[model samples]
Each structure stands twice: as structure tokens, then as C-alpha cells.
Target chain A: MSLTKHPSVGEFLAGCEEHVNPYRPARLALCPMAADAEISDVSTSDTAREGDFVILWGSYTQIFGIVLKHGEIANNRFGNFHHDEIIGRHFGSRVRSRRGGLWLALLRPSPEFITQSLTHRTQIVYHADISLLRALLDARPGHIICEAGTGSGSVSASLSRALRPNGKLYTFEFHEERQKQAMADFSTYGVLDVVVSQHRDVCNHGFGEELKGQVHGVFLDLPAPWAAVPHVTKCLVFGGKVVAFSPCVEQVDKTATELRRSGYFDVRMLETLATNWGVKRQDATKKKRRTEGTTGTTAAQEAEEEEPKDVPKTSGTGEQWLSYQMPMRSHTGYLLVATRAPDGD
Target chain B: MKAKPTLGSHVVLRDLEGAQKVFLLSSGANRQELRMGKYSAIPLETLLSCPYGAILRREADGGWQRVRHSIEVAEETVEVQENNQHLAQDNSAQSLSPSEVRDLKQKCSGSEVVEALASNSATFASKTKFAQEKYLKKKAQKHVQQVTLLRPSVMELCETYYKQSRNKVCGLRYDYLSSLLCQADVRSGARFLVLDCAAGLVAGAMAQQLAGLGEIYRLFRGSYPEKGLLELDLSESEKSCVRAIHLEALESSDPWSSEWLRLPEAPGDAEGEAIAPGRAEARLTRITKRHNDFKSLEAKAVDGLIVVAEDADLCAEVLELGLPRLSFGGRVCVFGHHLQPLAALQGAWRAGNFVDVRLTQLFTREFQALPLRTHPFMVADANLCEGFILCGSKVGEAEPQEAAGEDSPTKKQRRS
Candidate 1:
């Protein structure tokens, strides 16, 4: 069966109704370029048109770049691909290189894909931690969330998608260069409407006075998350959540103690490890022949002996697919989750 | 920001021993009672005045009281014996009899009862400081008649269900569910087709994350299973976004035909009793709505497809029927308890023009991050296999002849 036809970028954008938020400016005003060029939903778009960022995925490599500017070539080990060849193609298309006859899948940009391909400014959060963080923080539409020390903006991108359409993410980064790079990446990724990047140290200056008691959740990825515990207590609403990502158990101990001291209840710490499995199909004939050879019997003899009942009969196609866990990251960091106490307690 | 628990809504009550149960706070005539441990049932109405995270304790008079102070044990350097060598495991260590303890519980508060039990213990004073604290904490968990009221969210609901009744939710772990949501790129303002058989846990979670922004078509085989969805604290608008469609209706060639739209005859009409006009009208409206929801879903491609079935073959069948309805670049994720069934779908996905196929199993460990006690929680079956997730991205069609020949080279390269 042929693949289902998808709505074009223009049609999809036309179908979207603007949702106004009183806490922030109008959606178009946040990104002026979007007003003129119309920022496509990179996370859901099917076609990779001009000015859209896409992922060129090879067998063992992935290159992320913008499809704008004519004649811009994406050079990789696979081959060189012109931006002109990428535009007007549906995402997940296998396009052949101009000279090398090599092919790569052109994929639509998504937060998960971006996390795997983005340039690292600091230690980035992988999919495992990012997924758990969304659940722990209860990040959803119409909620205001605060994230500190936007190291590489990978987690910010993922969180921005979770808080899209009406929600906002106030992300603070201490380093100037990293903040600028993250802002540029956010703009490229078409999530500037949901993310507001600041170049200040939240651990020192706090998340501003206006945000006090307004945020629904706070996430700290700082070296000293306990230093910002007091600020989180002030900025979070009653019954709000705060999560701290620390690599060391000592950090978690200090952070948990500080959270308890600040009247936060139900403090929990967890680490998630994702095990990837490799699936391979085992041929039935090869296994049978190998077993026959080991038994010092010819194939014909083994076939005749099958009726004697000691030989095991392989079921189904005998070409069974098996999965085994591959080597994975043993440790990432500890996620400390706690809820703010109710008002007056 | 301070959203209090409303009447007729569900809230999770976590006891001191970390056991959680969801309770519906009904009002006036429909008020219910919550039974905790061996104590008497407490009226659910008493919890109406408490805030979301307020801790409630049972008083000596058998009334619930909100605890204003923190419940953490203060850390102080107490004069302690060198070790727990003086402590004995003999039954004589506790001087209080079972009948006497039961009597003390009727007259004293939970803390007072704990204090009396500790004082009657012969070896409690001779134990080290750490041992003494652990002993008191263990005793408190048993004697305390307290629970913290938590607002119901997807996280709390999933954890509560996984802990209390794993089979009810199809052994779906919260972390795996979270990974599924992320991998599928579930977000606001997107349309998703969900086929959830896990007591509506998956459907309810997507609705919670959508938060009144997107549309969810919950497909079911027979009667709808909405226990988990009803337990969530969703607004009227949010609940309205989730529409249930019968699987039979999807398979019908003409959903709007009269044959499909004809209402079922009312049962027990032996006396030719006339059906109520309002009830008939309601049934007609429901039938029309079901057909109309399917028609609208057929009108456009959905952004994502999520299937959590009891078996892998059913998951494969659903994916086959759902792949055509999924938009280009849309994600497809299937949940199963075993790997063989999930692995068997790899060929089907490859043939169906899906890319980036991955089979992932998550292993999570919870650590008790306390001073000098930082280690993974030591418990039997703490790391049970939650389940497996097989996910891929649907893409545009490839030339049939070239597609068959194009896969081998990449497979060989990846192998090398």
C-alpha cells in the first residue's frame, strides 16, 4: 500500500488557530521572522521545504543543517548533497548523492533527533533523562516552567515541545556563549515562541522577582543546585515541583537535605538506564546443519533420526529473530524530585 | 496556582509506608469513606478542606487533623553505644503484649502510641543512634494513621497503579510510558489515534499531556474501559477532547449507513414497554457521534499512533490498520511485554516504509539518597522487566523494486 498523503506546510499552518496567552506577548510578536516566513512546525512537518531545518541521516552518521541558501552543500562521508536537492522532498526520503551514488534518509527535525545530533556545549541530557524529567515535572500545556543553566539547550528543546501552543519556559543560562548558542539553536529549531532565554545565573540572582510564586515547575541542572533551592521555593507555586540533576550521590544528599529544609515533601531520587537491543534473524537451515555436524551425523542421517525423538524439532519458520541487550551508558545522573509544601505549611 | 481538590474529583492518598491509593472526594449524599491500615474508616468529606499536599493524621478522638509542622526526624548527635551488639532479636525485647498495644491505640494518638511502644522496648535504649532511628521509623510506619493528599496527575496515577495493581495497567511502568510519549513526539495541538487496552491508562495520559489542546480518538474493541481516565483530574473541556470509537465502526465500510446507525433494541421489553423518549434520543445521539468521530478521523491524517495491546500480534494488526491513517513523518509506538513479538514486527515495519525502527527496554533504579544510606533500594524484584517498546517513523513510499535491493547494502555496512 502507498503511504498516506500528508498535508502541506501551508495547509497545516492554515488549520492552526492561534491560542492567546495573557501572561506573554502575542505569538507572532515573539518571533518576527515567523510573521513573515511562517515558522513551520519542525516537530511534525512532513515536507522539508526551503528555510526548514532537516536531518540528513546516513547509516552511521546524522548531520543537522538548514535547507536555506541555494547551492549550500552538506558534505559527509556518504557524499555531498545540495540543499536544492533536499528541498521539495518529503521527510524520510532516501535521496542519492550527486556523484557518490550513496543514499541517506532525509528526516524531519524533532527534539529527540536534535538531541542526538546537536553540538554539545556542556554535558547534555539524553532521551532517558529527558523523558523522565517531563513526567516528574508534569510539564504540559498552559503551564509555566523554569529551567536553569541551559547548558546545551537539548533539554530545553524537548521541554519547549511539551509546553507548546500556550505554555512558556523561562530558561536561564550562566555562561554567555552557551546561552547565545542555545538561543540561535532555538531560533533555528522554530521554538522561540515557547522558550525565553536569559543570560543570568539563576543560582545567584534567582529567577527574577516577577516570576515569584508563578512558575508551576522548576528544573535545576547546575553544579550547585542546592544554592538555588531557596530561589526555587520562592518562585514555585504552592504544590509545585522541582527536579535537580546531579551526577554525584553527594550532590543528591545535599540537594535532598536542602529540599527537606525548605519544606518540600516526598523527596525522591532515581536514575533511568535504557538498554538497546540488536535484533537478528537466525536461519533455520544453518542451525540444523551445525547441530547435525556437532552430532557427527550426516544431514540425511539426522533427518532419519528425527523420528527417534531425541532430536529437538524447531517450531515455526525456525528463522527466529532474537534480541540481545547492547552495551549502554551505565550511569547518567541522579534525578531528585520533590514537591513544594502547601500554602501555610 | 493554588488549585484545591474539588468535590467529585480523584486524589491520591499516600500513607506513611509509601502505599498510595486513589480516592474520590464525593460530597453530601454521596460521601465515601477511606479505610487506612487497621484503623476505622475515615469519612472522605474530612479531606475536602485540606489542601493538595496537606498531611492528615488521626487524632485520639478518631478525627482527622491537618499536620502543620514538618514530619522529618531531626538529626542530632545523640550519645549512643558503640554498636548494636547489645540489641537482641528475642521476643522478650518488647514488654508490651498485643492486647495491651491494641488498647493503647484506642486511647492514644499515633505518635503517643509509638512513644509508648518505644519506651516498652527493652533494647531500644541500648541500640546505636542509627539503629534507634531506624527502629523508630519502622514502628512509626506501622502505628501512624496518616496520609498525605496529593493532586492526581499522570505521574501519580501511573505510579499508584503500577504499585498497587500492575496487571491492571498491563505492567506498563511509568518510565517506559514516559519514554513512549517522548519517542512518539506527543505534544499539544496534534491529533493522535490511541488504541489502549490497559484500562485506559495510555489514553488518559495523552489527554493529560494534551491539556485541552489536541484531539484523542480512543479506539476500543468492545465496551470502553475508562477507569483510569475517570480517575484523572481533567477539566470538562479536556475530557471532551477524548472521543471513544468502537473498533467495529472503524471496520465498517459505511459508518453512516442506516444498518450501522440503527440503535440496538432495548432489552427486557417482553410486555412491549415503550422506551423513554429522552433515552432513545440520547442513544441516537451517541450512535451518530460515534460514526461522526470516525468520519472526521478519516478526513485527515493523524500526527501519531500509539498502541498498547495484550499481545504482540494484536499490536501488529492494529499497526497495519493504523499505518495508513498516520501522516508522513508521524511516529508509531507499540508496547508489549515480551521481545519476540515486538521483534517479529521489524519485517512488517520495514515493508511498510517505516524508518528509524528501534526496540528499547528501560531499566530504572530508585536510590535511597540519605546520609550514609545512599544505595539502590534493596528489595526483592525491584528491577522487574517493565516491558518493551518498539517504535518507528512512517515515511513516504519508496520504489518497490529498488527498495528490496537497497536494504542489503546498508545492512551489511551496519554489520561491519
Candidate 2:
């Protein structure tokens, strides 16, 4: 893997030998800041070897790279990082450039890293939608699930993580190119076995007998979920669930009507709206403070509180908290969930 | 085969009358009947024996539709405007007396009753199709046989408490809680410290997110932790991940009081000294090991920290004990009812031990989605905790900025 001033991403990814799987997405799993863990401790059995898919994450930035032999260079705007420095080092080790002017940690790749940083082929599902669907569906370990219209493999990634250790996800994308692209991503992230992608119309041809009447959950991100309802009904087990993610109310209306006749009960439509706040530690309260104080996130508010005005300041006090701010996401879309009949068993 | 809704299982009970109550069903306990009024106290037993999430109805009625349509009816295209004024202008529209309608219900289903009641109306032939549909929709609510069993999710639990007793729960908005979980970076196999305000809503969710794989220390106030934790309906493994600690005890030099460690009193033996069963000994061993683990935990750091405490004193203790214990890059999340505490926290973080200091307040308004008329609900917001939160991450001292990709490569790269 030579350091080209402008190396193609595909070329770089093609040469990688292995990728990180069984990852916990939200938090970076391994780093020096993390507890001291060997490479084997952080990685699955099919761990990153020479040419494995590894990411070089700086304190604030990340670059996907190949795990190659000594003397090869991974050069970016930052500097030239020699392959020799990280080839024998552990996955979570912090390595510096040849001159030691810059530093980055050799870290494993997560699905989120692939989703947020990878190139997209279509409008993908958001993390909020994915997690909410997982929660609403009560996807448990060993629950086999089906997903249609795997647009950009965004939902596929989270599903792969959510049903880990035992479960598997059978995902389908109608378009050949997109399905092939998703397959590439699954391989890139080392989750090929966990998520099975197919290039077929699940609505026209029901999920073959391997999945017929046995899936724990089904997610439809298609245009006409009503058209797919019958196929999904045949695939879902007793008390299984189907969630149709439609942007339009009219689609939900048709889907609901079909589900009413499809022997599914307790069908309801919901819209997921998630909000993220900033929570941080302030300096420890320096004094026994007064009881009542108005709260605001303005300069004047902080300046107004020079002292508690009633209590004396002290040394060696602990930290305070600030819990005010705006959210990271707004409404995603309306989600409709319906359960198959319990008596069907 | 799956087990029925057991004593410890969290169940959302929908009585025959159609009111839903969410709670943990205890066996052989005198309690409010699931079907209400004269339904007997065996509600819990019956519910446990039945299938989980099965609707339990008091009475069964699969009646019929008897419509008198002897007269020839012409097909008419009649569209009704909403709340047609002319229909409401006149009175005395029904030929059947009230008792006659009740008699009809005894012999017919709600749809049948709607048909009979409509056919006998004085203005039945004069009304529009939409009006008739609306009338039938309203009538169905009164007669539909529905029940609720187990929808033990965070959303259902939040709504149940928010409507019943707002103060009894933390009142954290559903989406806001989800976002907090995401920001806290809560995941399986991640060690965390959680301080619950009142209802253990946050604490319970964290246990689920961890899925019993990691350690979870739950800090509570008063003598015991939140009773709402029962709402989580934790299995044996999920419950094992949770440890409830008195927040006040953290201030004491020996946080582990003797009370926390005292084994359950051994049953009296008249003739000989009784050795504790292996189960009891294992429980003691777990408690003792956890005690020592907590002692050692004070010396190291965890993956993340979450604080939902509203008490000013408790908030301070949570931060004092939680912030330093977070490893670098670990998330710190605080959810409260007001904005002041969160804002004050953001200001304090100007010292820059942390980065990505974010503050957010989330309020959600639901919309009624009908075929033609879709609008915001009259009550725009649910009775929710004035959900204000702040989340950020531990960062080592700030790194020097990279201007852009435009910057020339380092000199060392050329030689290499």
C-alpha cells in the first residue's frame, strides 16, 4: 500500500485483509484511553492481520487504512505514517508518524464508522430510526429478522450489531448494484455472515422457505408496504412484528388496512423524535452555595453569579453540572408496528 | 414455549372496560381486578396462567346483525360535511326508547346495534353516509371488546406514569431518553454509573441497554431505590447487572454500611447450628465481592456516567463521584427538569477538561392522522418532565487544529 497523494478509496479498501466485527457502535471501543487490552481482547477471532481493514483514528479525525508490512506509508494531510510503526503493534496502540510529529491510534472499525464515513449509494436509514425500530420490535438475541429495501445498508449495520452473538439478519435490496454495494460493505465491516443480502424482490417472490413463517421481525422500507404485507404475514411467526417505515400518511393508511386483514393485531403508528443534549462537568462548587438560583445559558447569567451572595467560597471543592441545550435530531418519520396474532401459534 | 405473565413480569393490563394499567403482577395478592368491579381477586392468578400479552375479556359475545331492510333502498351518492348543522337542528329522531336500545345491545354486537339504531332513526333515510359512518365509529368505542397485557416497553411505561402520576416518575421524554442513551454511548459490555432522580426510568433503561453484560451502579436517594424499577421487569440476568446504592452513603468514609452486607437472617434451627445453603452463601459472596469491587472502582474509571438527579445536593455528589471516574472519551450525560443546572454545568466546563459540550431541551407534540383531517392535538405537549439535558465527552487537552487538507505534508514524509 503505497502513499499516493490521491489514492482511490476503493483501491485502499480492496487491499485490506480483515475488518473489525462484533463492535459496539456509539463509543470507540478501544484506545489507550480505554483500559489496557490486547489486540485479541478487543477483536473477534477473525482479527485484523497484515492487510486487515483497520482505521487510523487521530484524537479528532479518522482515516481507513490497510494493515501492511514495514516501510509502507499511510500518508494524509497530517503526515506520513509508516506501516512499520503499527504492523506489530496492538490494535488499540497509539502510534506516531515517522518523525513523531503527529500521533494516531490504530483502532478497529465499527459499522457507524463505515456508515458515517463511507460513501453512500442511496438515502440510508438514520441511527435514531434504526435503534427505535430495534427497541419497538423487541429484537432479542437469536431472533432472526428480515429487512427489505436495504437502501444504503445503514439499518443493516445497526441490525447486525443489535442481534449479535446468535441472531442473523436477512436483508434484501431489489437493485443489483445496491445489493452488490451492500455486500461490499458487509464484507468491508466483516459482518458478511451476520447479515445476508440478496438481490431479489421480496414482494414478488416471498422470502423463500428458509425464512417462511419463522422470522421474529420484519422491517419494510419500501414504496408500497401494503404490497409486501401478505409476504411479510406469511414470513412472520405468531406474535411476530412488522414495522413499515413510510414517510407519507397515505402509505401508512393502506398498510394499516392490510394489516387489519392480515391477522396481525395491536397495530399502531408512531413517529420517532429523538433529541441529544450536551452534558458536561463544571469546576467543583467552591462554596456552600445558596439554595435558589435562576438557570440560563447566557454570559450574563454566569457573570451575575460572582458568588453565592450568601455563602463563603472554599478550596478543594468538587464539580458542578450543566444540563441545558438544544437537540441533535428532529422528527425522523412515522413508524407503524403491527403484531401477528398470538393464537396463530 | 414461553412462560405466562408471572409475578415479576411487567404487564399492561387492559380490563374489559378498556382502561389500561401497567404494573408488575404479584401472585396471590389482594389487588385491583384487571377487569375491575366484581371480577374477583384472582386477576393476578388468571393473568399469570394465561398467555402473556393476551387480551382478557370478562364476557364473551359474538352476536349478530339483524337489520330490517324489507323496503327497497335506492343507491344514493351522499357525502356528509363534518358536523352537518341541519342534522343537529331537529330533535326526537329515534323511534326506539333507551331501554329498547339496551335490549338491542344484549342481542347484537355494536355494529349490529348501530345498524338497528340507525335504521329506526326518524331521519335515518335523510342522513348522509359520512354521518352514519361517524355515528358507527363513536358507537364502536363503547362496545368493542379489547384488553391489554404485556407491552412492557419504555414508551408504554413512560406514557402510563405520565398520565397517572407525573411526579412519581422522572417524566423524561421518550425520545429525549433515547437520545441520552445514544449520547451516553450506552452499549453492551460497557461499565456505567447511573444516578436516578425519582422513578428509576433512566436506571432501568440503562440496564436494558447493557443487556446484563456489564456493571451498572445505580445511585438512589432516601432509604430505597425507585419503585419504578419493577416496571423494567428485569430477568435474573438483567437484574444482576444493577446495584442500587444509597447516594448519601457515598459521602461516608465507609460507603458500604453493615446493613448493605448483612446476610439474610438464617432460619432458626432448634437442634443444631444450621449452615447457610449454597445459594445463600453465594449471595453473600456476591455481595462481598461487589463491595470490594466498588472499593476498587473508586480507584479506576468507567466507560460512561449518567445523572438524572434533580436534587441540587445530589447533583453535586453525582458529578463529584462520576466525572473523575470517567475514562478519557467516555460520555457524561445529565437529564433534569429545568435548564439552569444544565446551563450552569456548560459554563463550568469552559475549563475545557471536556469537549463537544452540548445542551438540549426536547418537547414533542403529537398529531392526529386521520384520512382527511390531520392536525396537532389540542393538548400540544404531553405532561412531560421539562426535559433539559447536557451531554459531553472527556477529552485530553485540546489538539492543535489542522487548517485543512491544503496544508503541505510534514517534512519527514519527503525523506521517507
TM-score for each prediction? 0.88, 0.71
Q: Write candidate 1's Cα lDDT for A1-345 as tens digits.
A: 112344443454344333211112234233322211222222233456677777776643354545455778888777778888888766557766787446667776678888978998899999899999999998987789999989999899899878865689999999998899999988888787889999999888999999988999999999999999999988999899999999999899889989988899888999887887766665546654335365566877866543333222223454555555677899999999999999879
Q: Which regions of candidate 1 fall more than 4 Å away from where they truly are?
A: A1-46, A60-67, A286-318, B69-81, B253-273, B347-352, B404-409, B412-416
Q: Best lDDT goes to which candidate?
A: 1
Q: Can you write out model 2's per-residue Cα lDDT over B270-316, one digit (the tens) per residue?
A: 41236547766777687776576465455435557888765766776
The RMSD (Cα, Å) of candidate 2 is 10.5
**Can you give the lDDT of residue B235 in candidate 2?**
57
